[model samples]
Target chain A: MFSRRLAFFLVSLIALLLAVVAPAAAQESVTLDFYFPEATANNAQGIFEEYAAQFSEAHPNITINVVYQGSYTDNRTIIQTQTAAGEGPDVAVMLSTDLLSFIEAGTVVPVQQFVDSTEGGADYVADFFDAFLLNSVDENGQLWSIPFQRSTPILYYNADLFSEAGIEAAPANRDELVAAATALTAEGRSGLWFPSEGFPIWLFTAFQIAGGEPLVAERFDQVFFNTTATAEGLQYLLDLSKVHQVMPEGALSWGDGPTIFASGQAAMLVHTTGSLTRILSEAPFEVGTAFLPFGPAGEDGTGYGAPTGGGNLYIFANSSPEEQAAAWEWVQFLSSPEIQADWTARTGYIAARESAWATDTLTALVAEKPQYAVARDQLAFAGKEFTAFRSIDIQNVINTTLSSVIAGDVTDIPAALEAAQAQIDSLLAE
Target chain B: MQAALPVTNRSVSPARKPWSQRLLPYLMIAPTFLIVFLFTLKPAVSAVIDSTLKPARLAQDPPAFVGLQNYADLFNPTHHLGARFGGILLNTVLFAFGTVAIGMPLALGFALLINRRLPLRGVWRFGFVYPSLLPLIGAASIWAFIYADQVGLLAAILRAANPNWLGSPGLVLGAVIVVNVWSQTGYYMLLFLAGLQGIPRDLYEAAALDGANYWQQLLRLTLPLLRRTTLFVLTVSFTFAFQAVELLQGLTEGGPGDRSNLILYFIYQNIGERRNWGHINAITIILAVIVLVFTLSSFLFFERGGRESER
Candidate 1:
């Protein structure tokens, strides 16, 4: 009645704006491939599926395709193979130490971009434990990954054995560890199975950190393998068998430790938190957990050092921006305190987030089984794992050198490390 | 040789075959040719070329043409992979010779023992073949448990000695070889059994009628008569032994220091750990050459044996 033509034109302009904005809101459902290393957690496939289902229900526009890769090594192989062919998984949980390899290969996208863009993103990144986050960032402090299923090596001592041997408590220092092991060694069983064969390098690096210095720091190309740390670490392991006679002389597979401990063949085991659940369930005797015994208190306050191990969530470079966005949302949801609490409780992985400790799920779990809290408390002393450029090759050098000396094939530990350090330096020079 | 065939035939012939017939042979061999070319020849050639080239430190960068640099690394005394090349060669020779040399004779011995009429012969045949019937990996696992450090069946039986079977560098290779022989004897026994049945009975009868004893007949007739089967079995077994990988993978992992590290197992280990494909491919080329030499020599030796038997 006032101005019919003018009103019609205004309505037409509004209709045109609606057409532009509608499609932005209505996104096509993105299906993301999430590669998970199955061996890291118990029933990881089922747990991943449940989490994916929860995310899908919340978003309803993104579908997460959970894929179980065989092991951490297998995941690396698959990722490298697929990414070369340009069809890698949109998201994956690879070894935290695998960051350099993946980054150097240009196959991954830094989660830092998302961290910078999101509201209260700094606070979000700040929530994870410092020890776990050490392996997640680069030299420039560029965040390439997020800590999820984290682990550290801890001492699993047999309480019954302690009582039988008249030991006061779990060993807390090098001298005490030797004494307890000596006391526990008996007619049939050794006191401790310090695993150095199947899984040689990880636990050995813990010894290195406690002995004096870390094998490597943030720089991938840098390594310190010929120091007092390396010598003392290998010497300790060698003496455990050669001098103390508390363990066997030959290389014992780390995989066999649980069975040996459960069958009361080993009075104590130095293994990862990942095996805690299985050892706890399988042992007939009451299994008590404690922090690892520290080595020679060094100038830099190197005592009680354990490696922060297990996998981390990484967003790959090959994904579309839309898929990356969706994967980030999924990653955030997976690493949230609630989910992390449940994950820590269900699996033996240490909760990477400080907030997860306060959650009801984890608090209840720790209250029921105090063994669940040992690794968390030990996190105060835990340091970064032995990671470098070409990690596997360098690790093999360290492993074989240690294995050779421990197997009694070589008696000169210092000379062996010197030769190894030379070889490592040559390799890193490449 | 194959490419020369059509040209030589056409040139040396009095008359050419019809077009369809000329094409028939090629058509028949095309699938095999394509398959061999794609799977075997191509990869082999590619490996040879890749052996001369190395990828950049970071994989994304272009590969460098480092001619013979990888080969140099292979011979480098300081390098772990290279330091063990000599030991790997020795281990391979030991595995191949040890398995075939001992296993074949045991197989023939068992076959002769069973070739005569025995009670429940079928059951005995199945019993002897049972170990080989188990999958290679499965059989290796069984032996692994049997050879475990302590509390194993071997440990339990030999409680007085208390040997570390799979752990000792001095003993691991022999331990692995024992498992290989255990798995192989049954299989070679089956082959010998088939060959034993195929032997003409009249020849043995003729030897027996010559006033010869059982050992005489065995030395003269049985050994000569089974020449072809022996040749086939030995050739196959040596090739099989040279390529042994799964047993090591399951049992010893070529460890306690390269004591059991055969050539093939070393290559397999490198393929997993070594990022440089050039070096890995060089190792592969070396393994392939070893396999080739052993295979060629086995056939040549067996063929000479076949000819000597005729004489």
Candidate 2:
């Protein structure tokens, strides 16, 4: 009886071993090194890991190793450094505008390549918002990256401050913004604070979009900084702080803008929609979101526009074919309507695809907190983020132009901008 | 304990060493020499080469020689880059001068105060050096709060009279200087303390016997004795001021729009933000040359002073 029992135990153990080993032998396993940055999203790393686990569970052969890089720039640096050493992550989420940089470096495989190879390619590409896709294109107009944590600059206002000041609604037009800001202005709190420090080009670009005309057009080499609309926008911004004294007189920090509003130091703040969850959760009083206030630029004399800003998923060219295929699947999984809905619910990033909004996850989220839909609605008016060949250099030129004018270091705005335009052109001409 | 002793290759001959043995000194220094070559000399030479080339915008683009175009672009004058570059240099110079002018004297004063026997003299010395011992980031955060807008210690104290210390371009350089001075004074003070100790006690005694008062002895004895140390401190502080990237990064980030921008921070920005390697290398070479010239001149002056004093 003891021999029979021992023999049965050995048979069962063999069966279990076979069960584990059979699948291992039948299919090849792939491991992917995925690099991501810690943008202002809540628990982004945790959420990403959870998704990776879910994907791996569905596809047992593929395993993803998620590495959290520092900032978006740091992510690019890591990829470059690693690529130089013949080692790089299989996938990374870099700035959407950085598509050009990666494309120029030949480090990233265009998602279109995979999209074309996959089923429902046309519909899948079309599902993403046009505003986001604006920055996803390369010099040849190929969709090089897929938008992930897409965002737009929006007005985050304090409802309590609005009530206290007896303002009716969130500002829409330039006059309304000015009037509302003037009303909300107080001893400590400014009427409205726009962050203009440490890369103010984003803020300026948002304003310029509303003011009409992007800094750059369809061509990577072209720039339109010295336009009348740009001057009007600059004058208005200057007048708000310099002449009206409604906003603070110096460069406000993007890092501090949300916190300042949440802490009631600023009545209203102009910051990214990505900051929504943070601002909403942190504010003691009611918080509201709205489209960025328009300027008198469009045919209707009021144009509401903001540039989309965020990261995009790009599969590395250096990755193996199988890894690239797996990375592409991972990208699709993340950007799928269902996953994007869950993503939008977890973090306040605007859902990259319009279809994501219709999903139950986002439907319930939006219904529960209507403020979550503001950026999505405002996406209709959003434009391309500033991206060019050697974009960062051009951006610095524009940023310094804006900052110096604010700092009173440059007295001539038009001349400074014109010189910047010439400089930018010359930089591209080389 | 060896059963039998044997002379190995290490102790083979007194007349001539083996090749490996002969190469001992060079072998020992190989790592150091390689490190210096790889990190310092190679990069410096590459920077010079890079500065002369029109940078490849794309990594795959062929390297093209632009002669001194990269260097000239910095001072092109068409764009405000040249002007901006000039402004950055001026700001750095002012920063260096300000730190040296204010920091050295303050350091000397603290050293003098704690040098003499007083109650809890160790405590005073410790207090003076404590800030220097604290990490730069920590000191930066503390001062950031002090200089923070709307809700800061200075804001509370001045009651709305406090200007935007870190924000206002007019006052930002001064504000950064103050923070640098606060953190650096202690370090210079320690040097001063060493110099003070080196001065013979008999000199002060002799001056005292001659009926010199405390202030007079300080002027006639301590000041003259500390001239070398003082010069060293000034030169060191000035050189240090040029290397003030962390404080600027932590404090103002070379802003309210380039108000507090110094040379090192500008180079940092070029590398990190602009990614214009050619521009970065050019700026680096220029700043290095400036500091090198200043340092060499100061070294000569110090050497001359030492020689004349000896005579």
Q: Candidate 1 — which residues are off by over 4 angstroms?
A: A1-27, A38-41, A59-65, A297-303, B1-25, B156-161, B272-275
- Chain A only: TM-score per candidate: 0.91, 0.91
Candidate 1 residue-wise lDDT at B235: 78
Q: Rate the local accuracy (lDDT) of all candidates.
A: 0.82, 0.82
Single out the weakest 10-residue window by summed lDDT for candidate 2 chain A: A294-303
Pairs of residues clashing in candidate 2? none
Q: List TM-score per model, in order.
A: 0.89, 0.88
Two-chain DockQ for each candidate model: 0.31, 0.35
Q: Could you tell me which 10 consecutive residues in candidate 2 chain B have the lowest summed lDDT?
A: B268-277
Q: lDDT of model 1 at residue A272? A: 81
Which residue pairs of candidate 1 clash? none
